[model samples]
Target: MSDVMDYNSRLSDPASRKFETFSYLPAMDAASIKRQVEYLVKKGWNPAIEHIEPEYLMDSYWYMWKLPMFGETDVDRVLAEAKACHKANPNNHVRLVGYDNFKQSQGAAMVVYRGKTV
Candidate 1:
């Protein structure tokens, strides 16, 4: 149908590009980011930080800031680490990931900081 074609074209437009899971939504604020961290803590998921240059956004692997914070339930600490990563890699896209140890996989991931676009 023409309507469906139009919608698909809009979604594929470069100006409307999306990154990670939360990229489809509006940019999140500090409070909202903290809330997400809180949820990860409450869910007992280990938090980790990763970053990559905007050009490598489509890459499957991102450079991990550090090891995953296993058994870390403190929301503030997780947020602090994410912020530190962003500060160190100002020109890279910083993302937060919640690793589910039991499942041995990532339970959640979202871009917290977007790098400068040329």
Candidate 2:
């Protein structure tokens, strides 16, 4: 169980199209998103650094389009906070990386803000 505790190793355990950033929106439909992530892990919301990435659940939508979540249960501090939020938004246009299906790396995302391209 050592692919960083195996949360599907961050993607691609036969997942044709799974995604993170829940609070519920856009509907990628993982069986109603695994019952809303098992009701946010039974309302405990584990956090070695807090924030389970949902963008805003419903009204203030952000990354609900999918592939923008974040995690770091601490390791290199989530790549130094996704490289300092992608160097404070370097002309954002769809950038979020946390490989596992890509191979092995985990935590942090949100390299999008202005150069716009949802």
Candidate 3:
């Protein structure tokens, strides 16, 4: 399957759907996400948040703000931003992305939101 289709492989007929937004993996609760973020931080990776609308799912890029969480050792800040983004865009896709100093792109990512949570 293509990278886009990999977002939601369980769909029986994805082509028939109007629009869909999903994370690469199952959604992670706030605590679980915080733990991962903390781990990355300890490994010297900076945290950032991104989101994408379902209609724009064809766009592989995740929209990240210019200012990432830098020089911040607190996981609460990262958790807050992740929750805020997800709350603001409940129907959209949101993720916590981490970047290392040497990487031009996200080195690690976790899905904080995947549309409606069941």
Candidate 4:
């Protein structure tokens, strides 16, 4: 039996939200948004056009950014780039961004044993 338990932060509450389209708003511009898209692409993900919830999420984005598991990447650098994009334009067009986290695969069996932690 293994004592260490792995907790994945990826799993979070799923909820649907309502938002307005901030696309044309003067908050974020096209060039800056492109940078955000490029950053996501570099991280092996595509930039999704969604609204921020802001309540249960940081910056109201559900699954806003996905990072690689093993490969070494510059976290701060990428985040800074994204931040620049969001800041370059701040539009308050309400749009709904859905968020749902679940286990994609049942990898193995769970063995429950009556034991005490040492």
TM-score of each: 0.86, 0.22, 0.70, 0.24
TM-score of 1: 0.86
Quote the positional error of residue 12 for candidate 1 in Å.
11
Clash pairs (backbone) in predicted model 1: none
Of 3 and 4, the candidate ranking higher by lDDT:
3
Clashing pairs in 2: none
**Candidate 1 regions with alpha-carbon error over 4 angstroms:** 1-16
lDDT of residue 3 for candidate 3: 62
lDDT of 1 by residue, 1-118 (tens): 4553322313334435577768767899999999999998899999999999876677789999999999898889888999899999999889999999899999999999988755
Give the lowest summed-lDDT range of ten residues in model 3: 13-22
Off by over 4 Å in 3: 1-26, 116-118
Query: For residues 67-92, what per-residue lDDT tens digits would candidate 3 score against the true structure?
Result: 78886678887888878887788877
RMSD for each of the candidates = 3.4, 15.0, 5.9, 17.6
TM-score, model 3 to reference: 0.70
lDDT for each residue of candidate 4 in 1-118, tens digit (9 for 90 to 100): 8798543333242222222333223445545544543444454432222223234333534333233222224444434534543444233222211211133321111111111111
The lowest-lDDT stretch of 10 consecutive residues in candidate 1 is: 4-13
Selected candidate, larger TM-score, 1 vs 2:
1
**Number of clashing pairs per prediction, in order:** 0, 0, 0, 12
Measured with C-alpha atoms, the lDDT of residue 65 in candidate 2 is 29
